[model samples]
Target: MRRKQDKNIENKQREEETIPKKISYAEILELKKPDERKLFLRKTFLLIGLILFVLSIILFVFINTLVGLGLFLLSIWVISKYWTLQDHLLRESVYFHPKYQEFRETPTKKIQFFNFSFSRFIATVIMISLIIWNINTFGLELGHVGDTGHWWNLGALTWAYPLAIPLAILSLGLVGYIVIHPNLTIIYESENLYHIYEIRLFSPWLTEIPKNNIEAIRLHNSKNGPQWLYAVILFYIILLFKSGIALIEHPFQTNYIHSVHLIITASLTLLSIIILIAKQHCYFEIVTSDRLYEMWFDPALLHKRKMENIANFFCIEPIARDQHGFFDPLPKKSVNYDDQTRELLISTSRSYFRLCFGLFLIFIGIYSIFSYSLLGEFTAYTCLSYGFIVFFKGIKEDFSDKNNIIIEIDRENKQFKQKRIFSRILEYHFFNNLKSLQLHENTDKSPQYYPPKLDIFDIAGVIAIIFFIVQEYVYQIMVWAPKNIDFQNILVMLFELSIIITLIYLIIRPVDTINVGTKTIDNYIIQLPSLFRYSEKNGERNNFILSNVYKSKETKSFIKKRIILIIITISISAIIAVIDIFQFLP
Candidate 1:
């Protein structure tokens, strides 16, 4: 009798442990009633649109150049009204599956979204053909630039062709990768494991996250919601400044016919800005403890109701959080850790990758700005502005808030990973935001304004940059003097210098442990950063080294793989940029 009772109790406990925290959908999903504020907004937009339309007509009869500005404002108002109405309708009722009425525990549920659109297919075909055509064109150009031809008299043409070949090849390679890549794949298994694969075309490579290592599954909106706003502001500021200058200089003497084109251009630019702002809110992300999976919506595809419906059907919990958006219906953790391990403060190695890349971009931008080509100046300005923004952001993070630290422990691999203090926001649009998840010691004190410490790798990078600049300066001076200078010695010296710097950096920045004296701390509230990190003390009575023995080989292997990938990417970009902007013939 006693044995049977004990078995029953054990089974009940296991069942309880398996069950997720129950949440009522009705309680969370509120049917928003028609409010006065919404009504006011609707009316206000309609009024503005009407007024703008009337004003545009008046302007068209008088100052034709001003008509376009009026029309653009009217169009914006109309679009805003449409969006507001759409949102209101979507909030009226919860669009949910009948299955959601009763939560059923399924062994596995997989949602695969394959975005093979007709337009994308057409684009891929065009790109492939263009690449082939360019490759052929480049070969001809290269032949023309040979000693037999007057390539020197061609000046910029000579340099442009040589630069074009590599750029074309790089583009072709990237396009091919994108065309073959899968859109998005999500698989949720009974073992609390999520298998997610998200591949976008512009991304250099596909990321296949290792299975069963997810500590937490969350869905959130991206943090880059404001960067788009900044871009729009800059666009308008430039536009207004140009328009004001033109008006002052020309006045009534402004040619109405010629100004029509300018108006059209301005109108299109405004429309684009609106679209850009709208698109910023279109992203929904599924963040694992380690990996982040993001998907962009057309806004037309799934309304708020439909999105929630999909979430509910998939057993996802809907969450509304500030800073970043997280979805609901979190899966139960596959592996459970002791309470003590969870309490450990974690930190990751501070990789100055973003800083270095930003500096490289600024350098390129400066070069382009000075190159004195119209197109170069415009492109350079954009790059310089963005570089400054990123550079400042890195500084802010390093100085102020270090919000991206999280405690990530992989029981399967017996490895712990954490992002650095000043990690870049993972929410990326153009390129893949891959962070090297390396574990490091966690500081016991609160985030402090510590003096900047230059790492060995940073010094190496600076030295390389100095060498390149010095070599370029010398070569340029020689070229301007109309003298034939042999660059073979300089090239060899630069190559040797680079090799030595790289070796020194590697030797100094080895995978060895550091012994910064440790201290014992009593129980304190631990808040995780936006990203992942896990720290374990190296001393005695360190009850913190989470339940499992740290396997150095596994951790080192993981770190090495990520480091190699980053190095390869940086090297390729640097090579292409250097070739593209070769200023002197030496």
Candidate 2:
């Protein structure tokens, strides 16, 4: 009986695993003829071309006349081609999927109202206010006979002031139109589930998902804080440019420019506030499943196919105490989702705009360095110093690998050895025994995991030497002196050289030891006198003595070297200083 039950369950599972067939577009457009679709595309193309042509004409007439007119016609031609290509692609897509139909048979009533009222009102208000402000401040200049000492006196502002406002208004209106349009739709249907999307002019349309198609549903944050901040800064800069133009055109009309500035500043400031509010509310949430995922921002939401998604979902783990009663591990878990998902978040966050802003800043920095005489040398020195230090540190660490030596004592013999081991050595032993040895691997723990051969003092000395060299070069290039180099500079250089030499000697010294066995013995009792002392009594081992050999002969040699170098360095510095002082006095 149990066997029969298990067989039934297995059969049911197999039946449930069947994949659903996708719908085709040809079935969807069967209600309308091919000729009608072609006609509709033609009209859309013509409309788009006409709009582009009109915009071009207006811009051309207002700006450079002939050049404007030429560009205007060219833009119209380009827009026409763009529309035709878009139409062709859309038709091709629809033909390939005949069964696939739009989610909505008719446009939503809410969208129509939004388009006619809210969008139009906002656009009109913005357009009218901009026109009024520009005319009152800059338009008056065309009729004025005398110079008003305004930025209108400048050629660029004179041309830009009239063109920018209308263009901005037009862009806003277009965005609004895209949001409100209702004919566009997306449909998703499965064996048991159905999804429908009514596409508006403002955002992409999405369809419903089949329950079986969903693999797993997970939450994701799409907002990139850094990218958002960069975008805000960029917009602020653009507004500042507009304000600059206004300032140039009407130098005396501070009130008009100030108002414009206030408006732009307020809008941007409000946007930042909104972003902060959203972050507090966790406004960026993405619901991802196997078949599809939906990204929801405050004002907009989008759904994309699972195959077409690309996003980086960071899995943030909450703080937890380990068995050792210590809270240490805190790391974000991350995975790369599909590219479509990533792009969706990136587009909404205005990540590309942020990148452009970064590029702009880099260009500005470069320009400032080259164009400003006062900053040229300082910038050059700073960049050179940073580059040299980083390069030297990398090279020193790489070369110091040869200095690392690991000695493994037999487990049985470890009890016989007696030495006051340094804390560093103890740590090295603990890590080597407890954790897997990571020599060349660049893992998360690599930075903390010290290689066996490299000594701490050697590393420190190398760093110090690099710093001294860099400083010496900088002094040579920047500071001017008499026929003889400055005594202070010479002193600094000599002191650095002395330290480097001392460090080198300390690193190269051999390990000290003493043998305790007779000449005939093959395995002599090798006693490391610096670290340990063992006594043999009645042919048996007695108490083992331990010593801190690190501070003995090897350390003394290093210290002596340092002292000698310091004295020599000081003498050289003193001689140079005396020469410099005498030369000045003469």
Candidate 3:
């Protein structure tokens, strides 16, 4: 009986050792009601605070600068108090203490929610981005000209000075709103559910993932030590190379540029090297897959032991590692993707139409603006319209997330799917039914599987073509056409009609490339930036489906014509501008 009891005790200890550490943030915090109402109040306060802060800055610009400063400080103080109050409410909850990371353990000895706090990494990013984006604008507006006649807009006394206060408020408001939200990566209690809870102003955003569905947990460190160190060293070496060049080029010319470069490079080299990495901001991730999920994370966040326990608890197969002992970046498409199926991440697509149109509009706008209002009101209106057009188009291109397309190719199922982020539609096709995919470089946006759409740019092109045709026709009728009713007049009229038809064709060129009535198979067009850098080949852009399609003859022909047109148009307009006002810049 004693021996049996000892064996049972040993078994119990083994079971205890095997039991995975599961964290339940909600249960541990004893959160009862949905925090939506609470969050609503918090969001309202933040919005109001931001507006007031901006108002103070505006007041500062109009009134005395000191008055504006005082008001802004007051607004800032009020906002800070409100944030502190909001955090106080979060901390005062029954289970969670104000101190930080309070947790409650279950009877089974499972410790739930070791702790959750605001992410310092996120806060740091917000601060950095705000400073970088607004610095130039501030310099442009508020800065005074140097004694040597060097000028900048550095917020000196311009109306833009007021804008800085509001911008600061906006930045702080955003950081407070987002960074103060708790980070809950994974929380699980029983066999029934697993969840990731992020507390936001909207409420607790809880994504409950089923137990069997979770494939693997991997680590990603934002502050990659070795990579950062290498970059800093490379930057210093480049600076050193430049200094050497400067010494060779102007050995006796002492304007402080050479000395500045050398001093900065030398000062940073050692410090960047020996900051000996610590406290990484880590993101644990895995591709959302129906099969075994593959992920890689920093070992600091979830060590091998924790990974093994989690895998065992969830009944997941041990994540396979490559020969170098690193997790395989691309998970096998098959149970063993040896030969049956192949998955490829489609990377890099640029819209040549957008590019060409953007450049074309900017060219037109510059010419109109600098034409000295030669066409009077017509030139003024055109210049005004183009200003808005150029600004909006730039914002749409540079700031927008065009890389939200996710494609999945299931060779086993003979299926091709294109799914976009935040989109409900799943566009799919049969693999054998599809024939070709256009592969284009990032700089080469002319190649596309489908014809481009008709937009304002197309209309503008048509209008310009028509205007030129009209001008030519008027010139011919007044100067070249004989003042007699004869066969020549009929021929002239026919020529004008032909010009209209040609202009119409040019207007619809982008749209007419793809004939809807044709039975040709389409190549899936996936647009990305720096395609291979974040590709299935390198293993970074793992969330999307993958395929690498070589350039096709049909696509190539279309792209070649389109590119030649872009080039010719750009060259012609650029030459005109150079003659018209290359002085526009100087």
TM-score of each: 0.30, 0.29, 0.30
lDDT tens per residue, model 2, 1-586:
9999999999998785443344444543342233555657667767777776787777767766787677677767765654444332222222222235443222222111111223333434554455455455545444334232333454334322543454355446545654553334343334333343443444444444333323222222322222222222323333444454555567566445444544554354334323332231011222222223443322222221111121111111111222332321111111112211111000000012223322433343334344542223333233222222222222221121211212222122111111111111110110001111111112222111111132333343234333434444444434443445777757645654554454343333323232112122222222121211222222121222223233334336655664565456445544554555566653
Question: Cα miss at 117, model 3 (Å)?
Answer: 18
Q: List, residue by residue over 1-586, the lDDT tens digit for candidate 3.
A: 9999999999999998576545454543334233666667666767777887998889888877887788788778766755544322222212332135322221221212222223333433543453454344334333565321222243245322332343355346545644444333334444434444443343443333433233323332322322222222323333344453555457565455434434443343323322222223233443222322222232334433443344344333222222343322223221232344544443223334434444553454344434532222332233233333333333332122344433444445333333222111111112222232223233231222323333454445445444444444443454446565467656656754564464343332332111111013233233232223234355553222222222345544655665556446545644554444434535
Candidate 1's C-alpha lDDT? Answer: 0.38
Count clashing pairs, candidate 3: 24
- Ordered from best to worst lDDT, the candidate numbers read 3, 1, 2
**Candidate 2 Cα errors over 4 Å, as ranges:** 1-132, 140-143, 146-194, 201-221, 224-586
User: After TM-score superposition, what is the CA distance of residue 250 in candidate 3 from its true location, in Å?
Assistant: 8.6
Model 3 has an lDDT value of 0.38
Off by over 4 Å in 1: 1-220, 223-294, 298-341, 344-438, 441-475, 481-586
Clashes of 2: 34
RMSD to the true structure for each prediction, in A, is: 22.6, 22.5, 17.0
lDDT-wise, the better of 2 and 3 is: 3
Better of 1 and 2 by lDDT: 1
